[model samples]
Target: MKGISSYADTGRFEEISLASSSYSSILYDSIRDRPDFKAGLSEQAHLAAKFESEAKYSVLNGFSYISKHVNPHKKWGMLINLSSFAKDANLSLHRNCIYCSKAVDLNINAMVDNNYNTFYVAEKTEAGELGEDIAAMQQYPVTADTSVSTLLLSNIKQGERAIIVVPLKKKNFSHCMNFIHHAGDGIVVDGQQNKLYNFNNNADKKIFDSLYGAASSAIKPARIYITGKAPDIRNEAWEMIEHPYFPDNDWEEL
Candidate 1:
């Protein structure tokens, strides 16, 4: 008999046992079952084996395998080409990396002077729970407009460092939030707009406190920045920078 049309190889067909069904009902139920049940004749097992082999080799080459446990709907669980995953794996394998923790733990103070430092994190809200925007930044060096969904992704491409930002306090930041998040590590909040009096008055301390707090939270090394007058943090150990914005205000203080 001809195989189902949806099967990759329509000519292929698998044989099944009818021992569980009466001879009279065997043919009828076999025909009534779902297409996939009857379409199991293809070389799916062989294909899976081939994919596993490729996945292993890719891993040896610094590629990472993400188990499909996160989302089973995806066709493949292992994402081989993304540098972010590779970096995570590589960092974990480092002797001094401890437990191979996420880049979040790498000390920004030590890396502040390093030219290749590139990792950014941003706050992601979904269903009122914190999520990750790492995936979008992972596809950096984006080229060609794809869709509104990929707007963040299309703006970046591979071979570039990862950058993300999470605003601790403020609203009107969504417009430039993505840019800042992808620009570098750190927090950038509107002191004036958010009515962040303390932040405006103690920018440097706020910046230092932010990084110190993040590191204390078991987070990796991070860079913190603000867009207003900030007092200098005494004996500050992290990389902090001030980039003033919205200069129309007359209440300027260094």
Candidate 2:
């Protein structure tokens, strides 16, 4: 697994349960059950049980965390906006943050902004206290090459996975979509082959055809996170990021 895979998240995202006889994933089954491509091991499957379980449950994990601690009273407050995947603390999401809002019982006064709000991702490790200890994702500004699948996660190593949570619209809340990018190279075995795409190899042309706009990019934004290379002839505290493709969690101090 070395490239990023994107799945056009749709339909009822059931609470995944892999039966003993068959470790088939409800998410994977909804996409395709034909077993067209040969995925050697259970882990080889692009969005297998392991990957789907993580991506799907992380949402619940994050929501529970914010509801309990951030707003101990679960009252109106600001939350780390998850609208557009920006890593900078100051550059919070503009579009209504669904998950963050939901955590506070859909409190209209609960503004999704920066300030001291924390980015809720999965759950914090049991030993979490330090800033770097919390699992979070840093935003990698999408380039022309990154706009497509084949090139998005080309920089990551094989066998690892990345979760791609596509934010849904304000009107649509029933169907929640969660993408698991398992820098993987394989195919699934099931029915309904209409909603999957592997970054390494795939039969479908487009899996994310259902996704659309978030908002317009500003002419000159306040802050910008630089990924990949920091110019060879560098200046100040700038340095190269050893791993850029697998930036799963890079949040700020809570």
Candidate 3:
């Protein structure tokens, strides 16, 4: 698990020990055995409702209206940000609370929109191994990890092509969970070393032409890269992850 950094020396956040891996049985056990896990999940749900209510109120009243007098927008934003951190804490338990679970090697990422303070978590899995049960967990009220939708945006420009590299190691991605609360832009890459998957950007191909040109000259190319404008790349990525279809199975709910 990743260490929780103190925010502005306020010391509001503290680290809790958690299970080490996200194997299926371990996830099941944590939900069953860990009182803290269930308690945190419930707390997260509570915060989600509060945050939603505040957001809905702000939308109806106008953020500018709140910002003008009491600055409730800032206050609510900070509260929402804190809830984001709380969600991370709860998610950590889900992913790494058990002592005997096997490590699942894969990557998952959430694309964020800074302007709207929104998160779009990618629905990544380990090559679909026993994934149906877990995928359905997102929809089941009892099993949903609320943090999936509460974290920070990547602070990306509306049209720029950005990549949040999600390595196989869970620790590497854990810290990124709180990127929004810390006011940081999560990893932005040019996609040089990482293979660009599902390209939807329409940028100049020369963006990567030089790098690939040099690589191909030294060795036969294993794959080709292309670019395009990904105006809705976030939506596309989410749709692919949340509604994954394996010809043999349909979308099953918990």
Candidate 4:
């Protein structure tokens, strides 16, 4: 009796009763006439009945208790801006720049000039903020070895035109295409060998229209170079704006 266990805890009593009911209705003469077996089955039927009654009361009480409380979804917001990107960029600076005495002074000016606007769907965490905080929450910085992806993200805004420079990395060709698709408004500048790639024909046409004017603009074409092949460094010549990759699907009206 100690080793033999009951089905009370496992909820199998109800299953056995259901099977008994089905068998009772079948044309199995031998199964229907078994009085001793039927008498033993009465214990399982009683357990199932008790379980159902308790389950009903528990469910009703649980629902009533839950209905008395307010269930509010939590909100989250992030203000990511150029400053954070610069902080991240500092980690990637060349060893020589890190050692130079002028590094601090240079980064200060770079930070000031690297201004860009980022407006995004606000999370509950961002509620009641204004001005700079509103703009900062939308910024996303680029990661190491992802300059092309970073640049493409920087150039795009929801429903706005952008001229992006794609950095050349033989390994990240697919990442570049994904960045283009996410932008929803970007055009490849011809004659830039470093950062160009093939996009889906249908998607490319849409990007062409988004960048129509600037695509034809007379401004000096932005050069994209494979990482190691970046041209000679000039003081304060390179400008960087980094932001997070926001998907059009997740976008909500501000």
After best superposition, candidate 4 residue 224: deviation in angstroms?
A: 1.3
The per-model lDDT (C-alpha) reads: 0.21, 0.22, 0.20, 0.21
Worst 10-residue lDDT window for candidate 3 reads 99-108
Backbone clashes in model 4, listed as residue pairs: 78-137, 79-136, 79-137, 80-136, 80-139, 140-243, 140-244
lDDT of each residue in 1-254, candidate 4, tens digit only: 01111111110111122223232233223211323212211121222333334223442221112111111111111122223325553211111110111111111112223311211111112111011111111212223323333345354442222212222121111011111222232323221111222222444444333322122212211211111111112232112112122222221212
lDDT of 2 at 166: 28
In order of appearance, the predictions have TM-scores of 0.17, 0.24, 0.18, 0.17
lDDT (10s digit) by residue, model 2, range 1-254: 01112111221111212132122222232111224211111111232233234223442222222333322211111133442224443332222122222222211011112112222221211111101111232223332223323322343324222222322222121111122223233111100111223333332213321221122331110101111111111121211112112111222112
Show model 3 residue runs off by greater than 4 Å: 1-34, 38-52, 57-173, 176-254
Q: Which has the better TM-score: candidate 2, or candidate 3?
A: 2
CA lDDT, candidate 2, residue 38: 13
Residue 72 accuracy (lDDT) in model 4: 13
Model 3 lDDT per residue over 162-236, tens place: 112121111212111111111222212211111121112222112322222212112111110111112222222
Ranking by lDDT: 2, 4, 1, 3
Look at candidate 1 and tell me the lDDT of residue 107. Answer: 14
Please give, for residues 20-71, the per-residue lDDT of candidate 1 as tens digits: 3233322222111223221111122232343344333432111111111111
All-Cα superposition RMSD per candidate: 24.9, 22.3, 19.1, 31.4
Please report how far candidate 1 places residue 164 from its true position, in Å: 4.3
